[model samples]
Target: MPIRQLPDTLINQIAAGEVVERPASVVKELVENALDAGATRVDIDLEEGGARLIRIRDDGAGIAAEELPLAVSRHATSKIASLDDLEGVATLGFRGEALPSIASVSRFALISRRNGAEHGAALEIDGGRLGEVAPKPHPQGTTVEVRDLFFNVPARRKFLKAERTELSHIEEWLRQLALARPDVELRVSHNGKASRRWKGEGDLLSDVRINETLGEEFARNALRVDHSGAGLRLHGWIAQPAYNRASADQQYLYVNGRAVRDRSIAHAVKQAYADVLFHGRQPAYVLFLELDPRRVDVNVHPAKHEVRFRDSRLIHDFVYRTLHDALAETRAGSAVGVADAQPAYDPAQAARPDYNWRVPTRPLGLQVEETRAGYAALYGAPRAELAYGAPAPAGEAYAPPAGLDGPAPHPALPHSDDASLPPLGYAIAQLHGIYVLAETADGLIVIDMHAAHERIGYEKLKHAHDGEGLRTQPLLVPAALAVSEREADVAEREAPTLAALGFDVTRSGPQSLTLRSVPALLAHGDVEALLRDVLADLREHGESRRVAAARDELLATMACHGAVRANRRLTLPEMNALLREMEATERSGQCNHGRPTWARFSLSEIDRWFLRGR
Candidate 1:
């Protein structure tokens, strides 16, 4: 307990507590070391979930005979030579504590022969007891064998789970590593039988590797994202909203080739999917962020699983904007049609030379104006006519249509070309007073009328609000609220940001602030609670959107109430008009609440339902 130096073995045993938690942790360190050594192929052999034995052979630049002892010495490594090297470490394993700590808890042997060496050397260490190096025959590579892991530390060994559970942990970590380094071939064997193999090819991860690691469903639903600007680059695949998961298990994020879990990055991704994903749903993606190595500090954690960025706000905004823009293109009636965007494979058509796998494009000049004009004449004013009948006052239901179909029938709208049919097509009939059945060129589309109209109205409101800017209403008497000193500092510092959001706040006392005006859209909101939340957000995320969010929420509520209600009948022209507006709107694929607005069933799929082709 006094100021005394601990024995070398005791020091290593203590370090093992941090570096060697389980067989999987040992595997992680060894594999990372192998990768740093420029290994192209790594073969791992495990027994009893790597508790009894773990042998790793890598075709990398091996150690020299003279350096065999130092390789397992504490705080000795060839990865870094100076303080500058530690600042921006490009290698995966540079701590220099892994080998020594691992040796202290197990029976460890390291065998190596550098390229062109006529002979090889081997060293063995049993529970921190080092032995002299001895000559041994080995190929031009390195092989590390560990036996009876944690044999010297019974307490650590007791914490390890069962064989199957430990093996699963190892496999999961390997899968994550495989995603980061698709250029390295990895093979794993358990109990003398091979279990997993990942073939290495190409400078970047291929679709085949993604499919194998994540699954075919993910690969099929994923969209390629490549964006670069402002001294940063992000590229990877993100699944569409329809392919969401129940948990964050599939969200893999890497910062400069190192897998990390940063709250700012995660928050940014969640915000990007805020408008599209349903509540409680998690997005699945494999995103890689690349920036100058000096800009991020990887030394924040021993496991290298967390990173601190010099400009976290910049990084957060970049990630949010990139994914938000990509998802925006999936809106209804957008250039990317749902039917064409979701590709279908045909085995019979594989042999056809002229088969087109590309997404089809509709003609630009389709007389959309003429269609709108025709609908306006029949439906009267847009706000006055509901899908079922003329709009009644608040809380009163409009009379249902005399029949499912309208009283007056109009011919199908004209088109410039056969391919000029709008992506949503033309409405044929109403189903259950909620869904709109439409006929398309190659499929049938069923749309939720209420959901579709809600999305359309929401987008329109947003556009109008943005174009006109936030409208500020002066309060008759300024509202005053007390806050913490830190909150007051933020309020004073971000006065300009508050003004832009249609809020005018002035410091009153040491820890008090006065609000003179509020945004017209959020006039009825809880000003004190909203301001406090905004201050909290600014304190945590370096940015706050509470004002804008409150405004948007109000707009969403208005759109929901104004949307066509259930049990309302939609005539062909009214339905068609809604479809056109949806096509022209943003984020129309889903309503304000993130439920899908429309779905499509291809003709081939319909044929399969009835076995027509068979």
Candidate 2:
């Protein structure tokens, strides 16, 4: 087959496929053009998510009558004059494919006056065919209207989402653009009704804009971060460590005034928050990075959503370290206390719970002991002095506090754990031809032989009673616990609970706590350092678990210790034994926690993945 030339209309349509993926794409391109034209005020109106109608009016350098016809032509622009300009392209748009691509799939009209013109000229293009250019409107700026989008391309039209979903996308586009250029007042309307508007300079005013677009609650609970690093400056606001959203849709990022989605930046931000937030929970942030535009590439996508960076590692570390340090500073202040970071306590409705323990009077550190005997001697009922880096045995019959119920020694009850388990039960099920299950009955039962056990061990040490609810090993001398003013407040409120959990604490000063005795569970653990760490976690995560739930959760962690792991292959009897354990355990129906330990698809569902089901 010989290569042949594609028709102009078809060429424009193909370009449209890349540049005009949705109504929001159209808005974005037009808005970028408006801003590029040095528009001070832009008004955008849409109907049917820019399907039926879209009108963008901007007070900018209007198009000349002679240039009006070429405006709808492809590869025509005044943004770049030479190839050298491409290396330092600072404007939002430069490709000049926006107008032609938009006109190809939609009924496009442009009316503009070149400031000194007697009257504005109008040009119309329907399905990529140019109509006659004539004098029409009386305006000193430009106003573009696109209607009946995708009328000539019915297939694209069919792929459009619901009006609301499309409108949401359009709104998001407008928001990012507005944020990028806060000096340019922007007003967006869908179906002739106002949806969002922004009026301000593009500083760290994202909080105000977010409030206007999302809600006031976001504005009130935002954490403002403004810092500069080597060759890069970052300024934005993140929700308090504890405040989070269900989706990452609320996370907005901009590099050098251009909205972008750089995975490295996102990963770095997440790493900075490692262990601070719960799994699957996303934090809300409006982050902006200011750097030399020459160091970044914005030409990766036709939509300009993703960008390539020259030094991604450097940028990532800068963003992560800046936000992380900023958060620490804010947490230390009384204006944003530990209580304010908690989600469970609403300061607007009710008084927040005491979390004074989050304030630290000492530096933080970590140490691990392997043997049960080592742990026992270090933090036993009668605490003993022990040397560091000592090897110890693994197994011991450790007991819970005097009043609490310990694990049962008798055999588990006879029952099918899967059949009796509640919704989301079935902790772990055998995956092979034979079905094996693990569950908990008494307190919490783990199903997996591996994952459950590891998770249980991790959580046990995570929430153990060493200081708070676990037993404590006393230091030869009392350690000083650093306490922030807010942490002091939290400690004062939850002192009784802390005491019940085996912590003997006293307020040493305005910003200090004195430790007398820690819980037996944490006997060897550094009481001074752990309390501060716990205080920080509590501030960010809210109150530690209540007594009842705490006990169950701890038991669940313990159960996870004995569950099967994924890689640990078992014999038929071992699998059968695991099944019996799950059946005997009460919570065995599910994992130690609420996550589904197993999911069973019927024969029909299995057939679907293989394309066998019709």
Candidate 3:
């Protein structure tokens, strides 16, 4: 077979596959084009999930009649003058493929007039064939319409999800853009109804505007973050520690003025909040990072949503440190109450509706069925109860031990059920407020009063971890460390395991751990010192074969060193729970570090203390 050049239309369609993945991609391209044209106000309307129609009107410098023909031509752009300009490409739509690529698979129209033109001209293209530019009337700026997206490619069109999903993507895309340019007025309509509208005044502090677009509750809980270092400026708001979501969709990041989803920024934020939050929960934030444009490369991707920094390591460190400092300064006791409990929306300002499109709704129990089915579905088995055919067991559950050292069984000690002696090994004495003092047969036991209860819960988690693996939290910022000589050696050996625990530990120098990731549980822990400590410990102990075993040792070290201190006060149930967990635990004999966790006292000590005659 002889090789031949692919057709122009096919090439354009191929490019469209990269730039226009969905309705939102189309909106992103057009709106960006409008912004590049100096649009201060933009309007977007979608119909039939942007498959039937998408209209974007912008108030900016518009194309003249002569330029109308070239607007839909590939590589025809004013954003770049020569190939050298590619080195520091800044515009969001410089590829100049968006217009032509979009026109390749859909019916496209461009109507525009310069600021002082008598009348605007409109150019139409259907499936890449350009129609004659005809005289048309329009105000300053431009209006671009896309209809029947992927009409010529049935395969692409067929893959489109329900209308609502498509619309949601469009909404999300617009929201990120609006956040990037808070000064720009943006209005969005779906079908024929206005769903969102924002004021155009160049106000920078209109958190309310952002709230209107991104739920009001988010705005209310967001923490204002502002910092500058080494000629760089970072500004944005993050949700309070307690306010987080299950998905990372809530994280919005911007570089300069373009919305981006860079991992460095996400890693930094996670490191900042590592210890205080739990796994699978994401922090909500809208962060803006500003650096010299020359120091960053925005041309890495055609979509312009990811950038390459000149010194990524430095930038990562800066972001991590800044957020960490800000979080530290924030009062731990500060009320987490929402600034505005209820969102303020004008009922009269109704959102436009697309009556022609179906309102997307998933079937009830669809998720439940999928989750419950699991492997059953994979094996082509019908859904059924996991315990099908087994009658429910009938009985009163076993009663908890009535007292510490109760029934000659120590409830909190690991070896209590050794078939030799009770775990707690003592009888409960008089209960005083929150403390539980007990007498054992051998040693006099004095329990933590509180940890007595927490031990049980911690044991369950630890056992689960031993069977599976330790639970990890991604840090909000990477910790920094100038590792000690010994520490450096051990850190190098266990670096990978530490990373799995959610610490972004990178060896900057032979003796340095330029920490980028920290354990999620130590979100706010001092990164530098922690690295030093971990490494030092590893250096003290020889290398172990099993990484999992090493991780357990590290975890034990962390738990012993990080859990609530012994002297701290506790409630009755908390103390009791700790005791119960200790009883159920295999390591209840000692704390994570092999330190005796508790002391036992015998009932005979009471008579001796009371001075009663024997």
For TM-score, the strongest prediction is 1
> Candidate 1, 82: how far from true, in Å?
2.1
Task: Give one clash count per candidate, in the order shown.
Answer: 0, 46, 50
lDDT of 1 by residue, 134-249 (tens): 99999888999999999988888999899999999999889988888999999999999999999988445467678768987787667778899999999888877867899998
In terms of TM-score, which candidate is stronger, 1 or 2?
A: 1
Instruction: Write one digit per residue (lDDT tens) for candidate 2, span 1-614.
Output: 89999998999999999999988899889988988888988999999878899999999999998898788888999988887777667888888899999999999999998888889999999888899989987568899999999999999999999988988888877777765676788988887789767885554553446666546666655766778868899987776545566789788898878888887788767755543344687877888898887788877888778888887757776887787665433211113311233222122111111112222331111111212222343234222113123333455323334554422122333233222222212223444522334333222222344532333343445445433545445556777767689887666666775776666777878888777777654465455555665555345433342332344444555655544445655543233233322222222222333333333333455467789945
Worst 10 residues of 1 by lDDT: 346-355
TM-score of each: 0.86, 0.56, 0.60
- Cα error of candidate 3 at position 599, Å: 35
Q: Output the worst ten-in-a-row residue range by lDDT, candidate 2.
A: 345-354
550: Cα error in model 2, Å: 24
Write one digit per residue (lDDT tens) for candidate 3, span 1-614. Answer: 89999998899899898888988999999999999889989999889879899999999899989998787888889998876687666777677889999999899999999988999999999998889999998999999999999999999999999999999999888888877777789998888998888777645455755576667777766667788989889887777655678888888888878888777667667766653344567778888888887788888887777888887756776887787665543221122223543222121111111111212232222222322232132212331233112222465323333452422222332222122232343334424444455433334556653333333334445566667644455445544567656566666767775666555666667767666555444445454555555554344322221333344444555454445554555433233333333443433433332233455444456668878786
Q: Which stretches of candidate 2 lie over 4 Å from their true place?
A: 200-207, 330-333, 337-614
Pairs of residues at least 3 apart in sequence or in different chains that clash in candidate 1: none
